[model samples]
Target: MSYVLNDPAAFADESTDGFVAAHRSLVRRVPGGVARTTAVPEGHVAVVIGGGSGHYPAFGGLVGAGLADAAVLGNVFASPSAQQIYTVAKAVATEAGVLLSYGNYAGDVLNFDQAEQRLIAEGIPTRTVRVTDDIYSASSDERQKRRGIAGDLAVFRAAAWAAEQGLDLDAVAAVAARANERTRSMGVAFSGCTLPGATEPLFTVPEGQMAVGMGIHGEPGIGVQPLPTAKQLGELFVEALLAELPDGVTSVDGARLAVILNGLGSVKAEELFVIYATVSTELERAGATIVDPEVGEYATSFEMAGVSLTLLWLDDELESAWTAPAYAPAYRKGAVATGDTELLTDDDAAAETETIAAAATPEAAEAGRTARDVIVAIRDMIDREADELGRLDSIAGDGDHGIGMKRGTVAAARAAEAAADAGAGAGTVLALAGDAWADKAGGTSGALWGLALRAAGDVIGDTEAPSAHTVAEAVEAARAGIQNFGKAVVGDKTLVDSLVPFSDGLTARANEGAALAVAWAGAADDATRAAAATADLLPRMGRARPHMEKSLGTPDPGAISLALAMHAAASVLNHTTAQKEES
Candidate 1:
C-alpha cells in the first residue's frame, strides 16, 4: 500500500515535483520526464531511457552523468506517449544522435519506436534497444518476447556509458543490445502491490504460497507453489539464469557475470543480503566469477513485496562498460569527472507550452464544434464508467484503463475546445485532440487511439466539411492505422476487434446514401456488438497476454473503450442531424 498524500491520479506528477526539488543539482524537469541538470557536451549521443512511473531509480532516478541523459515517464505501469519521448530526446539530443532504451513491453516498444521515427524525420539520428531479459516471461527461444525486469539496469548503464564515451548512436545502441541479450531476470512475489487510493492489491497470492515468474506490473505469477526458504529461492534464481545462457555461451564455467539482487519495492536490504549470500555461493559453485554484485532496489514496482535477480554475462567490452562510474540520483558508483555546466535550477527548467493552429474554412470550423461536442461526450461517459472499466481491466491487466481513458478523453476534450476556439477546422481539432489524448494518457490504448484519431483526421481534411462517404473513409483509415501500428489482427483482442466491424458497417451504410449521422449510429451499434463479442476472446497481445485465461470472460478494455467513444461520437452526430432537420 502506498502511503502518499494527494490525489492518486496526480501522484506521479507531484512526486516528480519533489524529486526535482530535492535533486536540482543533478536533475532538472523536462516536458516528459527528467533530464540531467548538467550540460550535455556537443556531439554526445544522448541516451534517453524510460517506461512507466512506478519503476523509480529506473527512469527518472537514472538520469545523470553516467546513465540516461533524459527519461520519459508515463502513468503508473504504462508506457509514455510518443510525443513525450520525442520531446525528451530532442531536448537532450546532440550532433551524434540519440539512443532510446527501455523494457520490452508492448506499449513501450510501440511508443519508443514511434518516437525514434519522428526524431529521424526531424534529421536527428535515433536508435533503440529494448531490454528483454526476464527469463520467466517467455521460453528460451523466444528471448525477444521476454519482459524486462531488474535487468533494465544492465542495458541502460552500458548504453549510457557508451554514449558518455562519445560513441555514435549505432555503436551505443549495439552496446545496449549486447547487454540486454546477456541479461536475464526472474522473481517471486509473496504478496501484491496496491496502487495509490486503491483498496485492493493488484493481485494476491494465497497464504503460505508464492507466485513464481510474476511481472513488475502486479501481474500474477505464471506458477504458484508453497513458499520456499531463502536458500531454495536463491537456488531457483541461479538455476533459471544458468539454464538459459545467451548464444555462444554454452556453459557458465569461468564466465564473469554482473549480478543484481533487486528488491521489487518493500523487501528490506537485510533480507536481500541473506538471499544474495546464498546466490553468491551458488554462482561460484557453478564456476562463474561474479563482478560487482549489486543488491538494492533498482527497478521496483510500487510497494511490491518481492524481489528479482538479474544476471548479465560480461565479456571484455561489457566488463569495462559495467564498471564505469555513474552519477545518477539513485544508482551512483565511483566518482565521475566533473565538467558539467552550472546546474539547472528547478525554476529555470520549466518547459514551454505552446499551441499552433492551421488555417480553416468557416464550414469546416462549424464541423469542429461538433467534433468538440463529441469529445466532451466521451469525457462525460468515461468519467461515469471509469471504475467499471478499471475493474474489468484488473482481471488480467493493470486496473488503470478506466482512469487512463478518463485522462485521455478529458485531455482530448480540452485540446479540441482549444483548437475550435482558435478557429481551427474539424480535422485540425481532431488531430490536436488525438495528440493530447496520447500525451496525457500514455499507454498502449492511448497510442492506438492517437493513431486512429490522427488517421481519421487526415482523411477528413481541414479545407472542407466531411460528407458521409468521407466520414466512412476516415473510419476505414483509422482502422488501417490501428491495424498497422498495433500489428493486431481481428483475433488479437485489441481495439482492432471492434474497429474493423465499425469501419465495415459505416462503409456499408454510407454506400447506401445514408446520412453521416445515420451511418455512424449503425456503425456504433456494430462496434458495440463486436466489443461485447470480445468477452470470449483470449488476448494475444499487450499486458493481458500472460493472463489470457483470467480475461476469458471479459471484453478487452481497449476494444470496449473505443466502442464507447465511437458510440458517444455517433450520438453527437445524431443530435446535430436532428437540429438541422428541426431548423
Candidate 2:
C-alpha cells in the first residue's frame, strides 16, 4: 500500500508536482505532464512517451537528454486523456514532427490514437508506435495484442535515441516499432498492488504462491504456482525468452541482447542483483551475450511485490541506440555532454483554458442552469457509490474506475456550474463540463463520457431550448459517438451495454410524444436493467478480458456507473417537472 498522501484522489497530481520541483534542472512542468527543461535541437523529432502514473521512470523520469522530450501523465493505473496527450505533444513538437510511444493497453491506445489524429489535423506531423512485448499476455500469432510491461523502456529509449540522432518523424517511429518487435518480456507477482486509499490489494496471491504473467495495472496473472527460488525464477525467464526468439533472430546461441531486470515497486535492489546474477549466468550458459544490462526499478506498479525481465535482441543499429549515452532523473548511463538549458515562460507551461460564451437566449441560459444541477446530482450519486464500483472492478480489473468516475463528475459539476453562472447556454455548459471531466479524470471512462456529452451538446446548440424530440436526438447522437469512439458494442460488457438501451428507450418514448422527464425516467430504468444484465456476459475487451472467468458474476464498473449517472439525471428531471406542476 502507498503509505503517504495528502488526498488519495490527488496523490498522482501532488506527486507529479513534487517530482517536477525536485528535478527542475532536468524537467519543467507542462499542462498534461512534464517536458524537458533543456531545449532539444530545433526541428528534431521529439519523442513523447507516457502512460498511466505509478510506473515512475517509464514516463516522467524518462524526460531529459537522449530520452523522451515530454511525458503525458495520467492518474494511477489510468491512461491520460487525449487532451492531456495533445497538450504535452504540442509543447515539445517541432517542425520535424513528433513520435508518440507507450504501452499497448486499450485505454492508452484509444487516447494516444485520438491525440495522434488531432496533431495531424493541426498540421503537426505525428506518428505512434505502441509497445507490445509481454509474451504472457498473448501468443506469438497474437503478439500485437500483448500488454507492454518493462519492454516500454527499450522502445522509448530507442525512439528517443533515434530522434536524438536527428532522424525524421518516420524514421523515429520505425525505430520504435522495430524495438518493440525485438523486445520480449514476462512478469510475475508475489502479491498484488494496492491503490492509494484502497483497503486491500487489487488481487491477492495465496501464501507461498506466485502469480505468473501479471500485468502492471494490477491485473491478475493467467495462472498461479508455488513460489520458486531466485535461481529457478531466473531459469524460467531465460528459458521462456530463448524458446521464442523474435522473427529475425535465427538463434539465441550467439545473439546480443539488452536485458532489464526490473523491480516492480517493493522489490529491493539487493534481491534484483541476486536474480540478475542467476540471469546472467543462465544467459552466458546458453551462449548469448548480454550488453548494457539494467537491473533496478525502471518501471513499477506502486508497491507491487513483483518483477519483470525484458530481453531486447539487438541488431547492429539497435545496439548503437541501446548503448547510447543518456540522462534522465531515474535512469542514467554514461556522462552526457551538457549545454545551456532553455527556461520555459509562463505561457509555455500553461495549457489553454476554454472561454465561456454568452447564452443566445434567456431560455437557453435557464437550460444551462438545469444542466448544471443535473451534473451536481450525478456527482453526489457517484460519491456515494464509488466504493461499490471499485469493488466490482477489482474482481478482475484494475480498481480505479470508481475513483476515475468520481474525479470526472466532480470536475464536470464544477465546470457546468461555472458555465451556468457565466450565463452560458446549455450546449456550452455541457461542452465545458465534458472538457473538464476528460481533462481531470484521464481514463477510458472519462474520454467516452466526455465524447458523449460533447456530441449531445453539438446536437443541442445554444440557439433554443431543446424540445423532447430534440433531447431524444441528442441522446442518440451521444450514443453514436460513444460507440464510434470506444468501438464497444452492446454485448461487449462495457458502458455501451447500458448506454445503448438507454438511448433506444429515450428515443422510443420521445417518438411516442412522452414528456422529457417521463422519457428520461424510462430510459434510466432501461439502463439500470441493462447494466445489471452485464453480470452474465464475459468481457471481450480491455484488461478484464484476460481474467474473464473471475468477473463472471460481477457487473462491469463502467456499465453500472453509466446507469447511476442516468438515474441521477432522471431524478433532476423529475424534480424540475414537479416544480413546474406546483407552479
Using TM-score as the measure, the top candidate is: 2
lDDT of 2 by residue, 100-141 (tens): 999988888878988999999999999999999999998899
Clash-forming residue pairs, model 1:
none
Q: What is the lDDT of residue 231 in candidate 1?
A: 96
- TM-score of each prediction: 0.97, 0.98
Error of 1 at 100 (Å): 0.4
Once superposed on the true structure, which residue ranges of model 2 sit more than 4 Å away at CA?
345-347
Structure candidate 2, residue pairs in collision: none
Stretches of candidate 1 off by over 4 Å are 340-359
Compose the digit string of candidate 1's lDDT tens values, residues 1-583. 8887688888888988899888878888888888888767888899899999898887899888778888998888888999889888877887899989888888888899899999999899988888999888888888878888889899998998898788887899899999998898999999998887788898898999998988998788888999999999999999878988898687899899999999989899999999999999999999999999899999989988898999999999898888999888898899898863756544544555766565467888888888889889999999998988988888888788887888789899999999888888788888889989999888888898888788888889788888999988988998888888889999889888998999999999999999999899999999999999999999989888877898998998888988998888888998999998999
Q: Candidate 1 — worst ten consecutive residues by lDDT sum?
A: 340-349
Error of 1 at 293 (Å): 0.7
